[model samples]
Target: MSFGLFQREQRSLFGEILDWMLTPLLLLWPLSLALTWFVAQGIASKPFDRALEFNLQALTQFVVGQNGQVSFNLNAQARDLLRADDSDLVYYQVLDSRSQLISGEPDFPPPRDFETPEPGRVLLRDDLVRGDEVRVAYTWLARPDPERLVLMQVAETKGKRSTLAAEIIKGVMVPQFVILPLAVLLVWLALVRGIRPLNELEQRIRARKPDDLSPIEESAIPQEVAPLVSSINDLLARLTASLTTQRRFLADAAHQLKTPLAGLRMQAELAQRETDPVEIRGSLQQIARSSARATHTVNQLLALARAETTGRTLPSARIDLARLVRGVVQESVPRALEHGIDLGFEGPDHMPDDCLMDGNPILLQEMVRNLVDNAINYSGRGGVVTARVLLDPFSGVQILQVEDNGPGIPENEREFVLQPFYRALGTNVDGSGLGLAIVQEIAQQHGATVLMEDAHTDRSQRGLRAAVRFMPKTPRQE
Candidate 1:
């Protein structure tokens, strides 16, 4: 049963601490009581033994032998001197060499024999008498008579011994009992004070405004919490940068959309005011063109916003680069024919089904479509715009290049054209200028690289070659 109890789960930290503190006090309490009893017995027994020895010695002085007859006597003065105080009851016995009682109580046991007894050598032992425990001590008395030797034994009840011992233990341990609680209280107080700074820091953070991106003041914070505060401040800085970019994008988008809308409205008013059939037809044609441009610009703006706002964490799947390129080419074919530009795709004639990359198909299509559109729009009559998708075996990259043969961007203007709302100086075509920027954003999200390089060293091609190189789904090992 005791072993089974030991296998049970014990209590937690606070319970364990309380048990540890109180266990020693409870255990040592009994030990203290026992020690008190022992010391009290020894102290109380000492004087009784001495008086008994003195009485035995005094009675031995009365010993006399008249012609081999033995007689013993004790005086009244000596008997009166042997009485004890009210707190303790003392008993004594005197025995002759033959183990016969010469005086006092005969029921007391005789002292055990020692080979060589020394003067003042006391032998003390405990015994049960009438169901009460008692302490006894005995000493030997030597007389002038050669044959007359006496043994003295003393016995006392344990009441006075227990009382004196209890008092002694209380004197020693009372302060310890008082000091232990005080020590625990001090430890609790210190812990509360030590955690105050952390509470204050939490309150300060909770009190902050939602848009407040300022760095926290670290000087006032405790050293232990400074690292946490620094991390929070770094997060705030990143959030501030993201918010600033978003606000700039919104402002630019509104400004760009306003121009096409105003042009559409003015065309509509002019058409309403015309009366001649030719002039009215001309005004209507202008309105139609303006409205078409406005609609196209709006579509491109929406695509750009989607590309910019889409999270990079959107699920990536294996995309067939050849199929994607062919689809985009088909979509742009009509637009290409309208401008008198020859548009074609060059790759494995059958379209390599395994030319794959890890990317979002919609964003990938948008990237390819914008690049091709930009090429066709820039190419002049009788110009060739080629869309090619190649899986480079050596570099482990999927490369897409859209090249045009008319009015290629100058070396100085190529970088500027990629910026939002930026248009080339000589371009007369209506455009939102967000197409290439959207393409660049999508490419960046996919870990792809875009390069605007010369199609031919002679620069006779006249139009830009925009290429996006994507990392292959399965890269070749070095």
Candidate 2:
């Protein structure tokens, strides 16, 4: 029952501690009792053995021998002293060297072992005689002739020693029966007090509102728990920033969509009122353009959201930079041709087969498309927009670049353009302004750097160049 009582209930820290402390104490208690009992027996038997020695010596003095024969005759007064123990029966024996009982009890047993006890010394041992446990003390008396020496022995039943040993045991162990339970009670109380703080902490957490995200107080927390509190605080700060960004994005999207939708409604009304065929056609054309712009803005907003999401959780795969850039450039070529802008890839038609790196393919493709789209949109007509995937010889880095003969962003305004919905002033391009912002966020997630510089230094035709340099990794090379 004791071995598994704790296992039947849910595990408890307190119970485990008690088991560790108390099990050894309980198992050793009986062993300690047995050892104490043996020691008590030795203590109680000391006085009795001494008394037996005295009787054996007294009986030795009564030894008499005449004519080469020996006998023991105790007078009444000395014999009464020998039988003085009230609680136990006593017996005596005297024997000649030839093993014949010369006097005292005729049936008394002699000492089983004796090597002629030295002079006046008394020897004591325990033995059973006549079906009763008894202690025996014996001494040998010397005669004029060494061959006729006599032996004297005295024996007593063990009742007095047994009683004294029981008293010693009771005296030693009774106090422990009272103190052991008190000690266990004190330990349990201390454990309960020691663990009270954790219960209070759990209660405090449960009492909080479900929507509460405030940081836990570090000052009140124990040093062991402070790191957990700090981590929770960090998570809350990030979530607050994410929520703010989401709200602002929603507002911007609503504002951007409002303008185009109103224009579409106005253009539709204009077409309904106009009777002239040319004017009606022009209004319908305006309506079509407004719808196209709205669609393009929606797609750009979706791309920006996906870019933000991917920035938080980046997924990787082996991406061939040259192949991905070529595909994105081809997709943007029709738009480039519509504006009469010369759009072409500047590097090898097929880059080195080893031009590969780890990246999220979809996000990387979106980044390239945004860069090329920005170039084609602002470069106007008769300008070249080139997309390149080149490897740097010195650094062994793979670089993706988009160069255009467009009005380059001024040095002072370069940082602002990477922010959401930020457009440089004095430019007439119609854009949702999230293109480069999306590119910057995705680039950050891939551990790449974005650099902006002039494609040409000529004052009349200084063009903007945007480049992304990937951190180098050794690729499989044949």
Candidate 3:
């Protein structure tokens, strides 16, 4: 039962709109023709019907009463005049109350429901005369006696009415054949003009330079297409931000690598020049230190790059934050002992289901490792570093914190410390300043926030406390 009027895998907007507009007009044209033909027939038959009624009235005058009997006396001139018609043959009948034909054709059929005839009233009907359909107009005439009457009827063949109706149909329908196509063409032109804006938009996009990320102007766009334009503009804005971030990351990485690479090159040249065995060994030691620092810087750069990439492209799963923090702390114990720093973990022995959060395990572990390593390096010998994970029962927010007995970052430089290659003043730590930046990037990916504050409120022991606050898990995540 489906018309499937607009079936297409990839439909054209112009074609869809045109089909909707023209389908109804094309369908209704035939119905319009039918109605016009019906109306034309009625219009053509009116004049002929009036003529038959006039002739019927004229024939009634010939009726007369004589000696309590009805008769019709018509002269030859009047009868000849009545019969004079170029397109149709006319027939007439005169009958008495007893159903006796007194004059004219005796074969005329009686009117339907004519048993109680109203005297002196003319009525018109269609009936068959000699097997040919004709129009009949009939009337009753009163006699001198109140109970007696005469019936007069005049009928004519339908030849004249049929010819006029055909003429009217041709006059009305012949012009429409020429006009329909022209109307469709006008509609097509209108639709083309209406959708010209979208075509212009496509051209504008194609003509733009590859580096051009500017937004399209919204003022000139139609209200109907405003949403589409707005969405494209939003995409362009995000692409610009991503490109800017990549460019900055590359420039910062190049600048940071240059320092350690230059150091390694200089130390290598000095070791090659040394002739004394003691001097050679000392230069070799310095070269080893430079090489180690270069290796560490390269590794930090790679870690930062991985954290950013994983944030954007990696999928996440449910993980227990408490267990993850404990593992990272345990693994860092050897490194802590090498620096003579005491590192410990604190959290629930068995993590509850509510403490689980959704994240990339590899990235989250890298984030914790950077935080613990940074704490141990800055805390130095005999320093205490504690890593802990705790869950807020009421709010369901998960918290991961690394507290160290290192000089806290000044309040003014706390925000800057999270940016890559930024280090606090007067700190002698030999490390790339990328740990906090990696921590921040990973935290943001998991919908968490990072806070840098003092572990101890007292001014005498102002140790640093780096805390990450994870947003409450939704029911779906649980």
Error of 3 at 363 (Å): 3.7
Model 2, span 1-478: residue lDDT tens: 1242345356676677777777777777889999999999999999988887877777777788777778667798567857756789887788787778877677777666635456566888888778889998887776535655677778899999999999999998998788888987988888889777667777877888977767766676667667877898899888878988999999989999899899999999999999999999999999998999899889999999988875567668888888889999999889998999999997766555456677899999999999999999889998899999898655558889999998899989898898888899989998888899888988888889899888977767769999998976664334
Q: What lDDT tens digits, residue by residue, belong to model 3 across residues 144-180?
A: 4768777888889999989999999899888998899
Could you estimate the TM-score for every candidate? 0.63, 0.69, 0.78
Per-residue CA lDDT of model 1 for 400-458, tens digit only, reads: 89988867777798788887878888888778888898888899888888888887888
Model 3: how large is the Cα RMSD against the reference? 4.7
Query: Lowest summed-lDDT stretch of 10 residues in model 2?
Result: 1-10
Once fitted onto the true fold, the runs of candidate 2 whose alpha carbons sit more than 4 angstroms away are 1-213, 269-281, 311-314, 348-355, 473-478
Stretches of candidate 3 above 4 Å error? Answer: 1-11, 59-159, 217-231, 267-313, 350-358, 473-478
Q: Rate the local accuracy (lDDT) of all candidates.
A: 0.74, 0.83, 0.86
Model 1: lowest-lDDT 10 consecutive positions:
1-10
